[model samples]
Target: MALPVGIFALFVLMVLPIPPLLLDIFFVLNIAISVAVLMVALNARQPLDFSSFPSVLLFATLLRLALNVASTRIVLVNGHEGGNAAGEIIESFGQFLVGGNFAVGLFVFCILLIINMIVITKGAGRVSEVSARFVLDALPGKQMAIDADIAAGLITADEARTRRREVTIEADFYGSMDGASKFVKGDAIAALLILGVNIIAGFALGMISHGLSAGEAGELYITLAVGDALVAQVPALLLSIAAAAIVTRVADARDLSGQIGGQFADPRGWLPVALILAAIGMVPAMPQLIFFPAAAIAGALWWTLRQRAARPAPVEQPVEEVSPDRIDIADVSDQTLVTVELGYGLVHLVDKDKGAPLLTRITGIRKQLSRDLGFVLPQFRIRDSLDVGANEYRVLLGGLAIAHGTAKPSRLLAIDTGEVRPGHGLTGEATRDPSFDCPALWIDPAARDHAVSEGFLTVDPSTVIATHANQELLRNSDQLLGPEEVRALVDDLKERAPALIEAIHPDPLGLAALTRIFRALIADGIALAHPQPLLTSLALALQKTQDFDSVIDAVRADMGARLIARICEPGERLKVVTLDAALEGAILGGMVDPGTGQPLIEPDCGSMIAERVNRHIDEAKGPVALIVQPPARRALAALLRQRASRCLVLSINELPARQPVEVVGVIGADNPAHQLPAPTEEVQAA
Candidate 1:
């Protein structure tokens, strides 16, 4: 739409008596580019990830605006404005404001654009809006604001309105460059019309009184100017403002949270546009001044008023050098002894964009960070801080660790401290690392424990964590222990519970089971980290216990009878025709077994399992390491989706069903924790 108007403006300028300028060409280019952009945006199928758009637009706008300034400055400062220095810049810009044939054509086009925009606005308003997702740590982070509303359970529902909208008001930096306040669409149109009417009317009056006195000619120009101001500028001003107001109101409604102070602002722009448009429409001949100040001033005033209304009340600042009531750092977050151990090497922190991912143990808990990120350790109360260059910043979490690396041209994002959940053994790991340069954050001691349950981080012992109970010792365990010792250990476990420990045949059984279970919960998009350890421990205890028969029954009980029944079912099938029909969305009457018609596994208990299972299913995430082929896989998947206490359905295939849960810790079957592989095939044959 903007392009069509621009093209018509270009076509009109080509034939117009007045000379065209570079500014007019720039406007043409902008309209052309905007049209192309709109087409592309409409076709993108995926959710628009607008994370980088704002910054990119800001850079582009700034650069182009600078270009505009330089162009205008060079032209005006050198006294090269076709007219003169005082009004040449204005005249140059005024050419782009186009009236007469250009104005009429643009006016028709803008009307169409407005109508189409209204349709889009109304239709889009009816569609459901998707909420933005944020990145969080897998393990819980220390709380920042103990929001008052959270304490009152207000955040759970609608108490806290969604504040996810982002708004950017593109200010025309060319205002200062043009030696005028600003220019908007209305201003450009108004200016064009002003030029058109003045030129046409002035020519007509001059011809009409060919033999008249100079005073008569001057009177004609004055009459044209006054008549335009009263009959046209006044009404046109009101109309332009009304249009802007309507557009702004609709915009505000559509983006309640995004109406920033400067959004939909800059009436100076509209004023210019309005003046140009009005000037073009009146009496064909223009006046001498041609509404020189009218449009720009009016638009500027309107913009100022809009922005002024939204400015926030100023915050009262403390004037005294020493704040008498200022509290100590310890007042908000008492220092803790325990610290989280982030295990990434110094290299990781240096190349943090890639390294940050590699260094953190982000489960789908607080943040659903990928597994490869490793254990992102946190500083104690006095660890790292933004105190990078501060005169002094007393350590908050343990001490700081600033691993040295060559600086980049610019450091976009840097996290100096881990969110420390206060009580969970922070002080124990609060050792110092002066090598690191980042902020150290601390939490209230009591706060950490209350925030996290044990199961959240209770990962399998096989998977190598950044900082586990033992680091160096575990690394050398393989080298120190002979093959015979390892064999003996395996032999002993097999002998003790031959049935349960039938074999430790290398497989992703443990890892797949664990990952699968959690993955399902994670997809549920709900919180469910609490039962991981409980389930893992149960799997281990069952594997180790001597009383296999009794424990299997207990396992069934712990798993809930329905899950057992499902797993014990005969075949694989995709039961849920849709996600809504899955156990997550199951209700009593809708899905009762046909024969018994009994609420498929009693309604009350089903609800409880659904809640618990949903939570776990949402958390377990990873690869399909252990493939369970055929009926077995199908049965397991069915059980997990429909009846499990807390489980996810990884592909149920040839993978062994009785594998211990510890496998989850292992990345794959060829784990460092597992026994060495068998000898070559030739050697086995011999």
Candidate 2:
């Protein structure tokens, strides 16, 4: 309301006639506003801190233009009345400031105009244009950086949002300033034109209407015209300077003065200044007295700054003191689910000065695994360990060593994947590839091209470690997931399908139960990458049963087609290994767990089944599924989990009806043989 009323008042001044007293008050107010804006611009720590500067500049320019119109009207109508006819402020400028000399006043006004328009306004406009363009061009990169930080867990979602908002505001501020600078440039030009109008119109009206001679009209009208122009030009110059200062500012923690003062406080910069001034003072042609005093002041400043630089920074007080007897939980236990411990010799792989190649590889692995797996993997920790050999690194899961290998930091590993030429001349140490147990040679980096020519795949030491870690992590992904990950998954799903989440969570199932279900699914090779469909399947499964195993079995049956799709493409025959009917029945009835009421196979029988499954897989030379009865599925899956991990075990009901099948081998048969089942309707549907 106040702003609207003030704007209305400005327009009123331009239209309605005002007394000299009121006009004088407006003149003082315009000058005060310009100074206030300049001070605010200088005091701002960053351009965004004074985000309203563009609007302030606009309003101030408008007020000055209005004042010009009111003053011009008064000057032309009353030039014959004398200098005081306009106002005391104008009168003071015309008589005292310029000593009643219109020519001198005109010359002074032109000097100020040239300084404002050509020097300050032009330069500020150019700066604003370039700054706006650069900021807009880098906007996407800034946004991407914030998102990357969020993905790396370096910042939370709220922090990322705040940073994104700040980036948008900064871009907007600079863009506004880019256009606002034109206001200053135009205001300068307008002031010049208005001054011309006053002089030409005042001279003509005085001679024609008031019947005065040319000299009298010139003396009376030109002086008041020059005075009015100077009064308006003073504020215009202040504003142009203000505009320049705002656009030229760089973001800092301190204001402009403090930032400049802090940088100039260095004693090293001052010593050279003092020496240069002293050398100039010794020259005969220079002003000796003035130059000597300037040299002495510079030398004194250098000494004072040197003393300040020599002072030591104060030490901060410790927040808390630890007792010698006290033991902390963090010291005794590792909180991270996954940790990579490097030996002293391998420490250089993770050094930042060396580009942290190992860390970079690990981050890439984490991102890839997060996409393949369902949930975000927790951050992995890297630390130095003395327990391992100098060239060895160990990966730990839940504080237990899961994988350990050695890497030679000074050489590359040339892997022989049955492709290397026989008797190729490559000299290095012989070793086995830790990732796949392939034959490999640790060759010099200089021989990488030769190794490639000999059909050897060359990889650096960091890739070897990172690849090994990735394999181990993928195999143990079930262990990486917890209740927190499940909660996050649920929260994310709730955003898209709240009703679907509401059907299963906190009603028929709790968070712990859902976490266990998800872990079981992941262990069975069902990724949570597409949770909407998986959760929807789970929600439908909950409609029939609430028992943990029953719900899991139901969901697995619902998602049977997706599971089959992961291993075999559409319209392709799936290579399968089935159990002998008699053997499967025997195992299904042999033993039952009292707690789970689930059929369990005897240890010897389980080992025999696992061995046969592994043999069938080797013969097939590709991924094969072991199809069994629903009652015997869990028992066989557990038996072959570690021994024949490559063979996927599925129940009869879990196999999709439309999937084509080829019976590659029959496990537990008298003579193992490959048999293609007839293309009958029943076999095709199974």
Candidate 3:
């Protein structure tokens, strides 16, 4: 309210009767002050002092001083006596200065300057020190440790499991980031205050001007300068802390990382935008009427465009006519992996800028395989593949690693819809199609020779079948059989026997497929009982029909423990996972990745371990008790606290060997066991 009226009064003074010399002197003082500040800041190696801003003030002051001086000198020399005509008019505009009015204005400006200096001097040094300290830390991960301890006969496995889950929950609600949530509170408050103050000041000035009947509004020019300079400082501090907090939290979240937050969470970007904008707004007479709001509108539009671009398509395109073939048991070969490049069936050539998904058909194939199979399937790990730009995934039921065979690859495809087309296939470095040169295998060689000699089958040297038929034929043969019958039969298989080795478990593809199926079953809460019976049946069937040992190994892993237990029934292994209640709070809260610090993985499992451990280990006392209250209301405080000398670590390998020892937490907890808070979701997961 006072600003617009004040500007008018100042304008009036510029034309009032007074000494021209004093008005010029005041202007000169302002120029000298800005320059002095700049020179000092430069000498101190401080950032340049408001380079553009002080220039604005400097130019205004100098221009006004020059005009006043030019009029004074011209009138004095060009006119009669010592009195100059033009200088007289300039003199009339300076009447306010003859009184105490100018002195008061100068005093007010000086007071404000002192306050600014006090704030800067007090804040700059501390901020620098804090900034340096944050620069030297790393992100967080201790879940592996917690898991190990559980396996090591220290803490209870169930407790460890609970803590890991807690960690995830806490991160979901509060963010795995260090200070993000806390900083938001402060930022929101400060931003609101700034917005409120500016709006009120602008409106109040408008009303005062309306009352004055000058069709003029309050002078917000100076108010804007002061408000911006003052209000901007709030975010400068708030956001700096926020950035630091995010860096800390995320650093703690990641592991196998060089440092936490590496580059992703750095505050270098956000803080500057706000401060820079505030500064531009503070320029005196900069005519903010056009650019300021326009920049805001432009930024919003750009962000909206980018977001629209990033969102993925709602669903995969519908599968239409391609080929008509029902791939059967013989199609998938043993000890072989095949990947077909599903042609960019939808669009032969990708339109880089215009198309959605923006990836080649091969990428789409991988996505499908990943979706149908599992993200971390063993089959993917072991098998080799190449996309032929054909819209299909085919299986090789019979193929050798280094031998050539005559067989066709087949896949089930919809023949009715003809949108997607198939192209020739490529393998390794060579292109292959219906007549490709690739190695393959069939029935067990031992059984094959016996059958041929016994005159049990017709001769077709080029054909090979799955091994199970050969095994049964040999077993029923009157020709002699031995204790190592299966092994001898396998050794006799000549088609690709030289390249075959017993696989203990499913390869990456097999693993992924199984996992995907398992996940799907779980999604609908399907039953999951002991794997032994199911594995045994699959193993026996495959062994009898295909002579494949993939299922055999699967069953072996499932029942190996039981068989081992029966053999050594007196001594059984210990628990699976565990944790210590005492070391709840001592684990580090926030650190960045050692490599590319991003917040620990999406739901940093380790950070939760750190949180839980820290909480368990209180400040004053040596140990505390952990408690889990019923009806867990929130993820934040789910576990109860307990006190002890050290958390009891246990051994998962030998159940009888459970041991006690502290893992992570403060050395001595000050609070009572009951006072300890529950573990955060992230902590439980860790």
Instruction: Name the candidate, 1 or 3, with the larger TM-score value.
Output: 1
Off by over 4 Å in 3: 1-338, 341-377, 381-686
- In model 1, what is the error at residue 129, expressed in angstroms? 30
Tens-digit lDDT track for model 1 on 1-686? 95467445544433432322444344344434434433332322221222222232333233233323333332223222223221333332223233323334335434533433343323222221111111122112212111222222224223322211211111111111121112223333543455355435544545464543445433333233222222222222332232222222322223322444346465444656766755664645755255545555665677777687578979889687867798877777633322223222222331333423212321111122212111212222212334243222221122332221221111111222444343544322222222233432222334344323321121111112222312321222222223332344335545555543332212223433333333332332211223333234345645666243333334333443233233333333212111222432333334555663333444564455445435333343321122232222333344444344334343322222432232232211233222223345665467
Per-residue lDDT for 508 in model 2? 78
lDDT for 99 (candidate 3) = 30
Runs of candidate 2 with Cα error greater than 4 angstroms are 1-33, 51-100, 113-236, 243-253, 257-320, 345-355, 415-433, 436-441, 449-458, 591-621, 670-686
* Per-residue lDDT value at 673 in model 3: 28
Candidate 2 per-residue lDDT over residues 82-105, each given as its tens digit: 988999999888888899999999
Candidates in order have lDDT scores of 0.32, 0.87, 0.32
> Could you give candidate 3's per-residue lDDT for residues 1-686 as a string of tens digits?
65466445445444554444643454344345445544432332111112232233223333333333343333322322222233333222222222323234334434433433334323433443443344322112335444433422345647877767654433332232222223333433443344344335444544553342222222222222222222223323333332333222332223313243244334344345545554676688765765466546545545655575577979978988646586666666442232111123422222233321212222333334334322211121112234332332222312322122222122111111122223312112122221111221222334444333333232222111112122222222211122232233234432333323222124322543444433422221121233334334444434544322233323333343332332223332211112333432222233434663322222454455435545555442233222211111012121211112122221122222222222223223443323223345665567
